[model samples]
Target chain A: MKAKIYVTLKPGVLDPQGKAVAHSLHDLGFDDVADVRQGKYLEVELTTPDKKKARADLEEMCKKLLANTVIEDYRIEIE
Target chain B: MKSAVIVYPGSNCDRDMQVALRKITGSEPLMVWHGDSDFDKVDLIAIPGGFAYGDYLRSGAIAARSPVMREVVRRANQGVFVLGVCNGFQIVAEAGLLPGALMRNRDLKFLCKDVHLRVENAKTAFTSHYAGGQVIRVPVAHFDGNYFASDDELKALEDNGQVVFRYCTGDGELTGEANVNGSMHSIAGIINKPGNVLGMMPHPERLIEDILGGRDGRALFKSLLKTFPLAA
Candidate 1:
Protein backbone atom coordinates (compact mmCIF):
# COMPACT_ATOMS: atom_id res chain seq x y z
CA MET A 1 0.00 0.00 0.00
CA LYS A 2 1.04 3.59 -0.68
CA ALA A 3 0.23 6.40 1.68
CA LYS A 4 0.46 10.18 1.54
CA ILE A 5 0.42 12.64 4.39
CA TYR A 6 -0.14 16.35 4.22
CA VAL A 7 1.20 18.40 7.05
CA THR A 8 0.15 22.04 7.48
CA LEU A 9 0.65 24.69 10.05
CA LYS A 10 -2.30 25.05 12.39
CA PRO A 11 -4.78 27.85 11.94
CA GLY A 12 -3.88 31.23 13.47
CA VAL A 13 -0.19 30.30 13.35
CA LEU A 14 2.02 32.47 11.18
CA ASP A 15 3.64 30.82 8.17
CA PRO A 16 6.51 33.05 7.15
CA GLN A 17 7.68 30.82 4.33
CA GLY A 18 4.20 30.67 2.87
CA LYS A 19 3.76 34.40 3.18
CA ALA A 20 7.10 35.01 1.48
CA VAL A 21 6.08 32.78 -1.38
CA ALA A 22 2.82 34.67 -1.73
CA HIS A 23 4.71 37.96 -1.82
CA SER A 24 7.14 36.66 -4.40
CA LEU A 25 4.27 35.56 -6.58
CA HIS A 26 2.72 39.02 -6.41
CA ASP A 27 6.02 40.65 -7.24
CA LEU A 28 6.35 38.42 -10.29
CA GLY A 29 3.02 39.68 -11.69
CA PHE A 30 0.82 36.87 -10.36
CA ASP A 31 -1.74 39.27 -8.92
CA ASP A 32 -4.54 36.70 -8.98
CA VAL A 33 -2.92 34.78 -6.13
CA ALA A 34 -4.69 35.51 -2.87
CA ASP A 35 -2.77 33.52 -0.29
CA VAL A 36 -0.42 30.57 0.10
CA ARG A 37 0.40 28.49 3.13
CA GLN A 38 3.33 26.16 2.71
CA GLY A 39 2.93 22.54 3.80
CA LYS A 40 4.79 19.25 3.58
CA TYR A 41 3.68 16.28 1.54
CA LEU A 42 5.06 12.89 2.51
CA GLU A 43 4.71 9.77 0.43
CA VAL A 44 5.34 6.40 1.98
CA GLU A 45 5.03 2.83 0.83
CA LEU A 46 3.89 0.28 3.38
CA THR A 47 4.06 -3.45 3.10
CA THR A 48 0.80 -3.95 4.91
CA PRO A 49 -2.32 -4.41 2.83
CA ASP A 50 -4.76 -3.59 5.64
CA LYS A 51 -6.12 -0.10 5.03
CA LYS A 52 -7.39 0.38 8.59
CA LYS A 53 -4.10 -0.62 10.16
CA ALA A 54 -2.14 1.42 7.67
CA ARG A 55 -4.16 4.53 8.42
CA ALA A 56 -3.75 4.05 12.16
CA ASP A 57 -0.01 3.48 11.82
CA LEU A 58 0.41 6.51 9.57
CA GLU A 59 -1.43 8.76 12.00
CA GLU A 60 0.73 7.53 14.81
CA MET A 61 3.83 8.17 12.75
CA CYS A 62 2.65 11.68 12.01
CA LYS A 63 2.00 12.42 15.65
CA LYS A 64 5.18 10.83 16.98
CA LEU A 65 7.80 12.05 14.51
CA LEU A 66 6.57 13.41 11.18
CA ALA A 67 4.80 16.50 12.55
CA ASN A 68 4.85 18.83 15.50
CA THR A 69 1.37 18.71 17.00
CA VAL A 70 1.81 22.03 18.75
CA ILE A 71 1.54 24.03 15.51
CA GLU A 72 0.99 21.48 12.79
CA ASP A 73 -1.95 19.33 11.66
CA TYR A 74 -1.59 16.31 9.46
CA ARG A 75 -3.91 14.15 7.33
CA ILE A 76 -3.15 10.77 5.88
CA GLU A 77 -4.51 9.02 2.81
CA ILE A 78 -3.81 5.42 1.84
CA GLU A 79 -4.01 3.98 -1.63
CA MET B 1 30.57 21.71 40.39
CA LYS B 2 30.86 18.67 38.17
CA SER B 3 29.04 19.36 34.89
CA ALA B 4 28.42 17.62 31.58
CA VAL B 5 27.95 19.09 28.15
CA ILE B 6 26.02 16.89 25.76
CA VAL B 7 27.68 16.77 22.34
CA TYR B 8 25.49 15.87 19.38
CA PRO B 9 26.90 14.98 15.99
CA GLY B 10 26.68 18.55 14.66
CA SER B 11 27.07 20.51 17.87
CA ASN B 12 29.75 23.18 17.35
CA CYS B 13 29.39 25.26 20.52
CA ASP B 14 29.95 22.54 23.13
CA ARG B 15 33.60 23.50 23.46
CA ASP B 16 32.71 27.16 23.92
CA MET B 17 30.27 26.38 26.71
CA GLN B 18 32.74 23.93 28.28
CA VAL B 19 35.45 26.58 28.24
CA ALA B 20 33.17 29.20 29.80
CA LEU B 21 32.09 26.88 32.60
CA ARG B 22 35.67 25.75 33.16
CA LYS B 23 36.84 29.33 33.51
CA ILE B 24 34.11 30.25 35.96
CA THR B 25 34.06 27.02 38.02
CA GLY B 26 37.73 26.07 37.43
CA SER B 27 36.72 22.52 36.55
CA GLU B 28 36.75 20.71 33.26
CA PRO B 29 33.26 19.63 32.22
CA LEU B 30 32.55 16.17 30.94
CA MET B 31 31.93 16.05 27.21
CA VAL B 32 29.24 13.43 26.96
CA TRP B 33 28.40 12.03 23.55
CA HIS B 34 24.83 11.69 22.30
CA GLY B 35 24.94 7.93 22.61
CA ASP B 36 25.74 8.00 26.32
CA SER B 37 23.11 6.56 28.65
CA ASP B 38 24.48 7.69 31.97
CA PHE B 39 25.04 11.27 33.18
CA ASP B 40 27.45 10.22 36.01
CA LYS B 41 26.29 12.46 38.88
CA VAL B 42 26.81 15.77 37.14
CA ASP B 43 25.66 18.95 38.82
CA LEU B 44 24.71 20.63 35.53
CA ILE B 45 23.92 19.54 32.00
CA ALA B 46 24.23 21.88 29.03
CA ILE B 47 23.02 21.40 25.51
CA PRO B 48 25.06 23.65 23.24
CA GLY B 49 24.16 25.28 19.92
CA GLY B 50 24.60 23.97 16.38
CA PHE B 51 22.67 22.53 13.43
CA ALA B 52 22.15 19.16 15.02
CA TYR B 53 21.40 16.29 12.67
CA GLY B 54 21.98 18.88 9.95
CA ASP B 55 18.56 20.32 10.85
CA TYR B 56 17.20 18.23 8.00
CA LEU B 57 13.48 18.11 8.85
CA ARG B 58 13.38 20.71 11.61
CA SER B 59 15.93 22.42 13.77
CA GLY B 60 16.81 20.23 16.77
CA ALA B 61 14.02 17.80 15.94
CA ILE B 62 16.33 14.86 15.28
CA ALA B 63 18.69 15.62 18.13
CA ALA B 64 15.84 15.89 20.61
CA ARG B 65 15.11 12.17 20.15
CA SER B 66 18.73 11.12 20.66
CA PRO B 67 19.74 8.75 23.46
CA VAL B 68 21.40 11.44 25.57
CA MET B 69 18.27 13.60 25.73
CA ARG B 70 16.35 10.73 27.27
CA GLU B 71 18.80 10.72 30.18
CA VAL B 72 18.95 14.51 30.20
CA VAL B 73 15.19 14.64 30.56
CA ARG B 74 15.25 12.05 33.29
CA ARG B 75 17.88 13.99 35.23
CA ALA B 76 16.19 17.32 34.61
CA ASN B 77 12.96 16.10 36.15
CA GLN B 78 14.93 15.13 39.26
CA GLY B 79 15.87 18.83 39.80
CA VAL B 80 19.04 18.91 37.74
CA PHE B 81 19.90 22.25 36.17
CA VAL B 82 19.62 21.95 32.39
CA LEU B 83 20.60 24.83 30.13
CA GLY B 84 19.87 24.85 26.42
CA VAL B 85 21.17 27.51 24.09
CA CYS B 86 20.18 28.38 20.47
CA ASN B 87 19.65 25.09 18.68
CA GLY B 88 19.89 23.60 22.13
CA PHE B 89 16.81 25.58 23.07
CA GLN B 90 14.93 24.13 20.16
CA ILE B 91 15.91 20.65 21.22
CA VAL B 92 14.67 21.23 24.74
CA ALA B 93 11.37 22.63 23.54
CA GLU B 94 10.92 19.76 21.11
CA ALA B 95 11.65 17.34 23.88
CA GLY B 96 9.01 19.06 26.08
CA LEU B 97 11.56 20.29 28.60
CA LEU B 98 10.29 23.85 28.10
CA PRO B 99 7.06 25.42 26.99
CA GLY B 100 6.51 26.72 23.49
CA ALA B 101 8.14 25.85 20.17
CA LEU B 102 10.72 27.85 18.25
CA MET B 103 9.79 28.52 14.64
CA ARG B 104 11.51 30.40 11.84
CA ASN B 105 12.20 34.06 12.39
CA ARG B 106 9.35 36.42 11.56
CA ASP B 107 11.41 38.10 8.90
CA LEU B 108 12.42 34.72 7.48
CA LYS B 109 16.10 35.42 7.90
CA PHE B 110 19.04 33.93 9.73
CA LEU B 111 19.61 36.62 12.33
CA CYS B 112 23.16 36.92 13.64
CA LYS B 113 23.99 39.93 15.78
CA ASP B 114 24.41 41.35 19.24
CA VAL B 115 20.97 41.86 20.73
CA HIS B 116 19.99 43.46 24.00
CA LEU B 117 17.77 41.65 26.49
CA ARG B 118 16.19 42.73 29.74
CA VAL B 119 16.28 40.43 32.73
CA GLU B 120 12.63 39.95 33.57
CA ASN B 121 13.20 37.72 36.60
CA ALA B 122 16.39 37.31 38.60
CA LYS B 123 15.15 34.98 41.33
CA THR B 124 15.91 31.83 39.38
CA ALA B 125 19.17 29.93 39.64
CA PHE B 126 20.27 31.12 36.22
CA THR B 127 19.78 34.88 36.67
CA SER B 128 20.38 35.47 40.38
CA HIS B 129 23.59 37.34 39.63
CA TYR B 130 21.75 40.01 37.63
CA ALA B 131 19.22 42.49 38.91
CA GLY B 132 15.70 42.39 37.61
CA GLY B 133 14.97 44.70 34.67
CA GLN B 134 18.67 45.10 33.94
CA VAL B 135 19.46 45.16 30.27
CA ILE B 136 22.24 42.86 29.05
CA ARG B 137 23.67 42.38 25.59
CA VAL B 138 24.07 38.88 24.20
CA PRO B 139 24.91 37.62 20.73
CA VAL B 140 22.30 35.49 18.91
CA ALA B 141 22.82 33.51 15.74
CA HIS B 142 19.99 31.38 14.41
CA PHE B 143 17.41 31.09 11.64
CA ASP B 144 14.60 29.71 13.81
CA GLY B 145 14.36 31.35 17.21
CA ASN B 146 10.91 32.89 17.30
CA TYR B 147 9.16 31.37 20.31
CA PHE B 148 5.48 30.39 20.14
CA ALA B 149 3.01 29.21 22.74
CA SER B 150 -0.74 29.12 23.21
CA ASP B 151 -2.45 32.10 24.78
CA ASP B 152 -3.19 30.20 27.96
CA GLU B 153 0.38 28.94 28.15
CA LEU B 154 1.65 32.48 27.81
CA LYS B 155 -0.64 33.64 30.57
CA ALA B 156 0.50 30.80 32.82
CA LEU B 157 4.12 31.58 32.14
CA GLU B 158 3.53 35.21 33.02
CA ASP B 159 1.54 34.33 36.12
CA ASN B 160 4.26 32.03 37.37
CA GLY B 161 7.08 34.47 36.49
CA GLN B 162 8.76 31.90 34.29
CA VAL B 163 9.66 34.56 31.77
CA VAL B 164 13.29 35.18 32.62
CA PHE B 165 14.27 37.47 29.74
CA ARG B 166 12.79 39.59 26.99
CA TYR B 167 14.24 41.40 24.04
CA CYS B 168 14.64 45.09 24.67
CA THR B 169 16.21 48.19 23.24
CA GLY B 170 19.48 49.48 24.66
CA ASP B 171 17.44 51.72 26.94
CA GLY B 172 15.52 48.68 28.20
CA GLU B 173 12.29 49.38 26.36
CA LEU B 174 10.50 46.69 24.39
CA THR B 175 10.26 47.38 20.67
CA GLY B 176 9.93 45.57 17.37
CA GLU B 177 13.53 46.26 16.42
CA ALA B 178 14.66 44.81 19.71
CA ASN B 179 12.74 41.64 18.93
CA VAL B 180 14.93 40.24 16.16
CA ASN B 181 12.97 36.97 15.97
CA GLY B 182 9.43 38.21 16.71
CA SER B 183 9.06 35.86 19.65
CA MET B 184 5.76 35.93 21.48
CA HIS B 185 5.67 38.85 23.93
CA SER B 186 9.28 39.50 22.88
CA ILE B 187 10.42 36.57 25.00
CA ALA B 188 14.15 35.85 24.73
CA GLY B 189 14.44 33.15 27.37
CA ILE B 190 12.24 31.27 29.80
CA ILE B 191 12.44 28.61 32.49
CA ASN B 192 10.30 25.54 32.76
CA LYS B 193 7.43 25.25 35.21
CA PRO B 194 9.71 23.70 37.86
CA GLY B 195 12.38 26.35 37.10
CA ASN B 196 15.23 23.85 36.89
CA VAL B 197 15.41 23.89 33.07
CA LEU B 198 16.14 27.02 31.05
CA GLY B 199 16.07 27.45 27.29
CA MET B 200 17.12 30.50 25.33
CA MET B 201 17.98 31.37 21.75
CA PRO B 202 20.87 33.69 22.53
CA HIS B 203 24.42 32.36 22.92
CA PRO B 204 25.58 33.44 26.38
CA GLU B 205 28.66 31.26 26.16
CA ARG B 206 29.78 33.16 23.08
CA LEU B 207 29.90 36.39 25.05
CA ILE B 208 31.55 35.23 28.27
CA GLU B 209 34.98 36.58 27.29
CA ASP B 210 35.87 40.27 26.96
CA ILE B 211 37.69 39.71 23.70
CA LEU B 212 34.46 38.43 22.15
CA GLY B 213 32.81 41.80 22.83
CA GLY B 214 31.38 41.83 26.36
CA ARG B 215 31.50 39.59 29.41
CA ASP B 216 27.86 40.18 30.32
CA GLY B 217 27.11 36.48 29.91
CA ARG B 218 29.54 35.64 32.72
CA ALA B 219 26.85 36.48 35.23
CA LEU B 220 24.80 33.46 34.12
CA PHE B 221 27.65 31.09 34.92
CA LYS B 222 28.39 32.94 38.13
CA SER B 223 24.81 32.71 39.24
CA LEU B 224 24.60 29.04 38.36
CA LEU B 225 27.75 28.38 40.34
CA LYS B 226 26.17 30.07 43.31
CA THR B 227 23.26 27.67 43.10
CA PHE B 228 25.60 24.70 43.50
CA PRO B 229 28.08 25.86 46.12
CA LEU B 230 29.91 22.56 46.12
CA ALA B 231 30.72 23.06 42.42
CA ALA B 232 32.77 26.11 43.43
Candidate 2:
Protein backbone atom coordinates (compact mmCIF):
# COMPACT_ATOMS: atom_id res chain seq x y z
CA MET A 1 0.00 0.00 0.00
CA LYS A 2 1.04 3.59 -0.54
CA ALA A 3 0.01 6.77 1.22
CA LYS A 4 0.18 10.34 -0.01
CA ILE A 5 0.57 13.14 2.49
CA TYR A 6 0.29 16.87 1.96
CA VAL A 7 1.77 19.00 4.71
CA THR A 8 1.01 22.71 4.54
CA LEU A 9 1.67 25.64 6.79
CA LYS A 10 -1.33 26.68 8.83
CA PRO A 11 -3.32 29.44 7.12
CA GLY A 12 -2.61 32.13 9.70
CA VAL A 13 1.09 31.38 9.84
CA LEU A 14 3.57 33.53 7.94
CA ASP A 15 4.84 31.95 4.73
CA PRO A 16 7.96 33.84 3.65
CA GLN A 17 8.87 31.42 0.90
CA GLY A 18 5.34 31.47 -0.43
CA LYS A 19 5.23 35.23 -0.25
CA ALA A 20 8.50 35.51 -2.10
CA VAL A 21 7.26 33.19 -4.78
CA ALA A 22 4.12 35.24 -5.10
CA HIS A 23 6.19 38.38 -5.53
CA SER A 24 8.25 36.70 -8.19
CA LEU A 25 5.14 35.60 -9.97
CA HIS A 26 3.84 39.16 -9.91
CA ASP A 27 7.14 40.45 -11.28
CA LEU A 28 6.75 37.96 -14.12
CA GLY A 29 3.31 39.48 -14.94
CA PHE A 30 1.14 36.91 -13.18
CA ASP A 31 -0.67 39.64 -11.25
CA ASP A 32 -3.82 37.54 -11.15
CA VAL A 33 -2.23 35.18 -8.59
CA ALA A 34 -3.74 36.52 -5.42
CA ASP A 35 -1.65 34.50 -2.98
CA VAL A 36 0.59 31.49 -2.66
CA ARG A 37 1.34 29.04 0.12
CA GLN A 38 4.03 26.41 0.34
CA GLY A 39 3.81 22.83 1.54
CA LYS A 40 5.33 19.37 1.28
CA TYR A 41 4.06 16.41 -0.68
CA LEU A 42 5.19 13.02 0.53
CA GLU A 43 4.48 9.50 -0.69
CA VAL A 44 5.07 6.62 1.66
CA GLU A 45 5.03 2.91 0.94
CA LEU A 46 3.46 0.95 3.76
CA THR A 47 3.70 -2.76 4.23
CA THR A 48 0.21 -2.97 5.68
CA PRO A 49 -2.49 -4.31 3.36
CA ASP A 50 -5.35 -2.91 5.37
CA LYS A 51 -6.44 0.57 4.34
CA LYS A 52 -7.35 1.41 7.94
CA LYS A 53 -3.96 0.28 9.15
CA ALA A 54 -2.20 2.31 6.46
CA ARG A 55 -4.10 5.45 7.42
CA ALA A 56 -3.28 4.94 11.10
CA ASP A 57 0.40 4.41 10.39
CA LEU A 58 0.56 7.42 8.11
CA GLU A 59 -1.16 9.52 10.74
CA GLU A 60 1.43 8.45 13.29
CA MET A 61 4.22 9.34 10.90
CA CYS A 62 2.80 12.80 10.33
CA LYS A 63 2.34 13.45 14.01
CA LYS A 64 5.78 12.17 14.91
CA LEU A 65 7.85 13.58 12.05
CA LEU A 66 6.16 14.26 8.73
CA ALA A 67 4.53 17.46 9.90
CA ASN A 68 5.11 19.87 12.74
CA THR A 69 1.61 20.12 14.10
CA VAL A 70 2.32 23.42 15.78
CA ILE A 71 2.45 25.31 12.49
CA GLU A 72 1.58 22.83 9.79
CA ASP A 73 -1.43 20.61 9.04
CA TYR A 74 -1.26 17.35 7.12
CA ARG A 75 -3.62 15.31 4.98
CA ILE A 76 -3.21 11.61 4.36
CA GLU A 77 -4.58 9.52 1.50
CA ILE A 78 -4.02 5.78 1.55
CA GLU A 79 -4.48 3.35 -1.31
CA MET B 1 29.13 21.65 36.90
CA LYS B 2 29.30 18.63 34.64
CA SER B 3 27.94 19.45 31.17
CA ALA B 4 27.55 17.54 27.94
CA VAL B 5 27.23 18.63 24.29
CA ILE B 6 25.23 16.50 21.87
CA VAL B 7 27.12 16.16 18.61
CA TYR B 8 24.99 15.24 15.64
CA PRO B 9 26.67 14.23 12.38
CA GLY B 10 26.41 17.75 10.99
CA SER B 11 26.78 19.60 14.24
CA ASN B 12 29.53 22.12 13.56
CA CYS B 13 29.26 24.14 16.72
CA ASP B 14 29.78 21.23 19.10
CA ARG B 15 33.42 22.14 19.57
CA ASP B 16 32.61 25.77 20.29
CA MET B 17 29.90 24.69 22.72
CA GLN B 18 32.31 22.33 24.46
CA VAL B 19 34.85 25.11 24.70
CA ALA B 20 32.32 27.48 26.18
CA LEU B 21 31.15 24.91 28.72
CA ARG B 22 34.65 23.93 29.76
CA LYS B 23 35.77 27.54 29.91
CA ILE B 24 32.95 28.52 32.19
CA THR B 25 32.68 25.47 34.50
CA GLY B 26 36.39 24.67 34.53
CA SER B 27 35.41 21.08 33.75
CA GLU B 28 35.46 19.33 30.44
CA PRO B 29 32.06 18.63 28.89
CA LEU B 30 31.29 15.18 27.55
CA MET B 31 31.02 14.89 23.79
CA VAL B 32 28.07 12.60 23.29
CA TRP B 33 27.48 11.29 19.81
CA HIS B 34 24.05 11.44 18.18
CA GLY B 35 23.93 7.64 17.80
CA ASP B 36 24.77 6.70 21.37
CA SER B 37 21.78 6.67 23.66
CA ASP B 38 23.72 6.28 26.88
CA PHE B 39 26.19 8.63 28.53
CA ASP B 40 27.16 9.86 31.97
CA LYS B 41 24.57 12.09 33.50
CA VAL B 42 25.44 15.77 33.48
CA ASP B 43 24.09 18.92 35.01
CA LEU B 44 23.53 20.54 31.60
CA ILE B 45 23.10 19.40 28.00
CA ALA B 46 23.64 21.68 25.03
CA ILE B 47 22.40 21.17 21.49
CA PRO B 48 24.68 23.41 19.50
CA GLY B 49 23.91 25.24 16.27
CA GLY B 50 24.72 23.50 12.97
CA PHE B 51 23.27 21.88 9.88
CA ALA B 52 22.43 18.58 11.51
CA TYR B 53 21.53 15.85 9.01
CA GLY B 54 22.22 18.53 6.39
CA ASP B 55 19.02 20.12 7.67
CA TYR B 56 16.92 17.85 5.50
CA LEU B 57 13.15 17.53 5.88
CA ARG B 58 13.32 20.69 8.00
CA SER B 59 16.11 22.36 9.93
CA GLY B 60 16.06 20.14 12.98
CA ALA B 61 13.45 17.57 12.06
CA ILE B 62 15.89 14.79 11.32
CA ALA B 63 18.25 15.37 14.20
CA ALA B 64 15.44 15.92 16.67
CA ARG B 65 14.40 12.31 16.12
CA SER B 66 17.92 10.92 16.33
CA PRO B 67 18.75 8.31 18.97
CA VAL B 68 20.50 10.86 21.19
CA MET B 69 17.62 13.34 21.06
CA ARG B 70 15.23 10.68 22.38
CA GLU B 71 17.50 10.36 25.40
CA VAL B 72 17.87 14.13 25.57
CA VAL B 73 14.12 14.44 25.72
CA ARG B 74 13.96 11.83 28.49
CA ARG B 75 16.68 13.58 30.45
CA ALA B 76 14.98 16.93 29.95
CA ASN B 77 11.76 15.47 31.32
CA GLN B 78 13.75 14.34 34.33
CA GLY B 79 14.54 18.01 35.10
CA VAL B 80 17.98 18.12 33.56
CA PHE B 81 18.81 21.55 32.14
CA VAL B 82 18.93 21.75 28.34
CA LEU B 83 20.13 24.71 26.28
CA GLY B 84 19.39 24.69 22.57
CA VAL B 85 21.00 27.28 20.33
CA CYS B 86 19.91 28.17 16.76
CA ASN B 87 19.38 24.84 15.02
CA GLY B 88 19.26 23.39 18.51
CA PHE B 89 16.25 25.61 19.13
CA GLN B 90 14.54 24.09 16.12
CA ILE B 91 15.42 20.60 17.29
CA VAL B 92 14.05 21.11 20.78
CA ALA B 93 10.89 22.62 19.38
CA GLU B 94 10.52 19.77 16.87
CA ALA B 95 11.22 17.25 19.59
CA GLY B 96 8.18 18.60 21.45
CA LEU B 97 10.30 20.00 24.25
CA LEU B 98 9.27 23.54 23.44
CA PRO B 99 6.24 25.19 21.96
CA GLY B 100 6.17 26.96 18.56
CA ALA B 101 8.41 26.53 15.53
CA LEU B 102 11.24 28.39 13.80
CA MET B 103 10.45 29.20 10.20
CA ARG B 104 12.06 31.02 7.31
CA ASN B 105 13.17 34.59 7.79
CA ARG B 106 10.77 37.29 6.72
CA ASP B 107 13.06 38.39 3.92
CA LEU B 108 13.68 34.80 2.94
CA LYS B 109 17.41 35.22 3.43
CA PHE B 110 19.98 33.54 5.64
CA LEU B 111 20.77 36.10 8.34
CA CYS B 112 24.20 36.15 9.93
CA LYS B 113 25.08 39.05 12.18
CA ASP B 114 24.88 40.56 15.61
CA VAL B 115 21.62 41.81 16.99
CA HIS B 116 20.54 43.31 20.26
CA LEU B 117 18.43 41.29 22.68
CA ARG B 118 16.66 42.55 25.75
CA VAL B 119 16.28 40.23 28.67
CA GLU B 120 12.57 39.85 29.17
CA ASN B 121 12.66 37.28 31.98
CA ALA B 122 15.77 37.10 34.07
CA LYS B 123 14.59 34.45 36.51
CA THR B 124 15.26 31.41 34.31
CA ALA B 125 18.22 29.06 34.78
CA PHE B 126 19.64 30.50 31.57
CA THR B 127 19.25 34.23 32.09
CA SER B 128 19.68 34.77 35.82
CA HIS B 129 22.88 36.63 35.18
CA TYR B 130 21.12 39.17 32.99
CA ALA B 131 19.06 41.85 34.60
CA GLY B 132 15.58 42.24 33.19
CA GLY B 133 15.46 44.93 30.46
CA GLN B 134 19.19 44.79 29.94
CA VAL B 135 20.23 44.67 26.30
CA ILE B 136 23.05 42.55 24.96
CA ARG B 137 24.55 41.92 21.56
CA VAL B 138 24.55 38.39 20.15
CA PRO B 139 24.99 36.95 16.71
CA VAL B 140 22.19 35.10 14.92
CA ALA B 141 22.92 32.89 11.96
CA HIS B 142 20.16 30.93 10.33
CA PHE B 143 17.65 30.96 7.52
CA ASP B 144 14.77 29.69 9.65
CA GLY B 145 15.16 31.60 12.85
CA ASN B 146 11.78 33.27 12.60
CA TYR B 147 9.58 31.97 15.42
CA PHE B 148 5.93 31.06 14.97
CA ALA B 149 3.27 29.86 17.37
CA SER B 150 -0.48 29.41 17.44
CA ASP B 151 -2.54 32.23 18.90
CA ASP B 152 -3.37 30.33 22.06
CA GLU B 153 0.17 29.12 22.47
CA LEU B 154 1.47 32.65 22.04
CA LYS B 155 -0.84 33.86 24.75
CA ALA B 156 0.27 31.06 27.06
CA LEU B 157 3.92 31.77 26.41
CA GLU B 158 3.44 35.43 27.16
CA ASP B 159 1.18 34.89 30.17
CA ASN B 160 3.49 32.28 31.68
CA GLY B 161 6.61 34.48 31.49
CA GLN B 162 8.21 31.95 29.15
CA VAL B 163 9.62 34.68 26.94
CA VAL B 164 13.18 35.14 28.17
CA PHE B 165 14.65 37.47 25.57
CA ARG B 166 13.34 39.78 22.89
CA TYR B 167 14.97 41.41 19.93
CA CYS B 168 15.38 45.05 20.70
CA THR B 169 17.33 48.18 19.97
CA GLY B 170 20.64 48.98 21.60
CA ASP B 171 18.69 51.15 24.02
CA GLY B 172 16.42 48.21 24.83
CA GLU B 173 13.28 49.37 23.11
CA LEU B 174 11.17 46.87 21.19
CA THR B 175 10.33 48.09 17.72
CA GLY B 176 9.61 46.67 14.31
CA GLU B 177 13.01 47.59 12.90
CA ALA B 178 14.70 45.77 15.77
CA ASN B 179 13.02 42.47 15.15
CA VAL B 180 15.77 40.53 13.42
CA ASN B 181 13.60 37.77 12.05
CA GLY B 182 9.88 38.47 12.43
CA SER B 183 9.63 36.37 15.58
CA MET B 184 6.37 36.71 17.44
CA HIS B 185 6.77 39.41 20.06
CA SER B 186 10.34 39.61 18.80
CA ILE B 187 11.14 36.69 21.07
CA ALA B 188 14.78 35.67 20.85
CA GLY B 189 14.74 33.03 23.54
CA ILE B 190 12.20 31.21 25.65
CA ILE B 191 12.11 28.87 28.61
CA ASN B 192 9.91 25.82 28.67
CA LYS B 193 7.04 25.33 31.12
CA PRO B 194 9.33 23.55 33.59
CA GLY B 195 11.90 26.36 33.20
CA ASN B 196 14.62 23.72 32.94
CA VAL B 197 14.88 23.97 29.17
CA LEU B 198 15.87 26.98 27.08
CA GLY B 199 15.84 27.49 23.30
CA MET B 200 17.28 30.55 21.62
CA MET B 201 18.29 31.52 18.11
CA PRO B 202 21.32 33.54 19.18
CA HIS B 203 24.76 31.98 19.54
CA PRO B 204 25.79 32.68 23.12
CA GLU B 205 28.72 30.30 22.91
CA ARG B 206 30.28 32.40 20.18
CA LEU B 207 30.86 35.50 22.29
CA ILE B 208 32.17 34.31 25.64
CA GLU B 209 35.42 36.28 25.55
CA ASP B 210 36.39 39.87 24.86
CA ILE B 211 38.62 38.73 22.02
CA LEU B 212 35.49 37.51 20.28
CA GLY B 213 34.49 41.22 19.91
CA GLY B 214 32.08 41.17 22.87
CA ARG B 215 31.33 39.23 26.01
CA ASP B 216 27.61 39.88 26.33
CA GLY B 217 26.90 36.22 25.75
CA ARG B 218 29.04 35.20 28.70
CA ALA B 219 26.23 35.92 31.13
CA LEU B 220 23.99 33.23 29.63
CA PHE B 221 26.55 30.52 30.30
CA LYS B 222 27.55 32.14 33.59
CA SER B 223 23.98 32.03 34.79
CA LEU B 224 24.01 28.24 34.50
CA LEU B 225 27.09 27.90 36.75
CA LYS B 226 26.96 30.79 39.19
CA THR B 227 30.18 29.84 40.94
CA PHE B 228 32.15 31.56 38.17
CA PRO B 229 30.96 34.94 36.93
CA LEU B 230 32.56 36.47 33.86
CA ALA B 231 35.06 38.97 35.21
CA ALA B 232 33.62 42.48 35.19
- Highest-scoring model, lDDT: 1
Work out the TM-score per prediction. 0.97, 0.96
Task: Write model 1 residue lDDT over B1-232, tens digit each, in one string.
Answer: 8889999889999999999999987788999999987758988999999988998777888888888998999999999999999999999998889988999999999999999999999999999999999999999999999999999999999999999999999999999988999999999999998889999999989988889899999999999889887535
Clashes of each: 1, 0
RMSD of 1: 1.2
What residue pairs are clashing in model 1? B1-B231
Estimate candidate 2's alpha-carbon lDDT, on a 0 to 1 scale: 0.91
Q: After superposition, how far is residue B22 of candidate 2 from its true place, in Å?
A: 0.7
Candidate 1 predicts chain B with a TM-score of 0.98
TM-score of 1: 0.97
Q: Per-residue lDDT tens digits of candidate 2, residues A1-53?
A: 88889999988888989988999999999989999999999999878788887
Worst 10 residues of 1 chain B by lDDT: B223-232
Each model's TM-score for chain A is 0.96, 0.95
The local lDDT score (0 to 100) that residue A34 gets in candidate 1 is 94
Which candidate wins on TM-score? Answer: 1
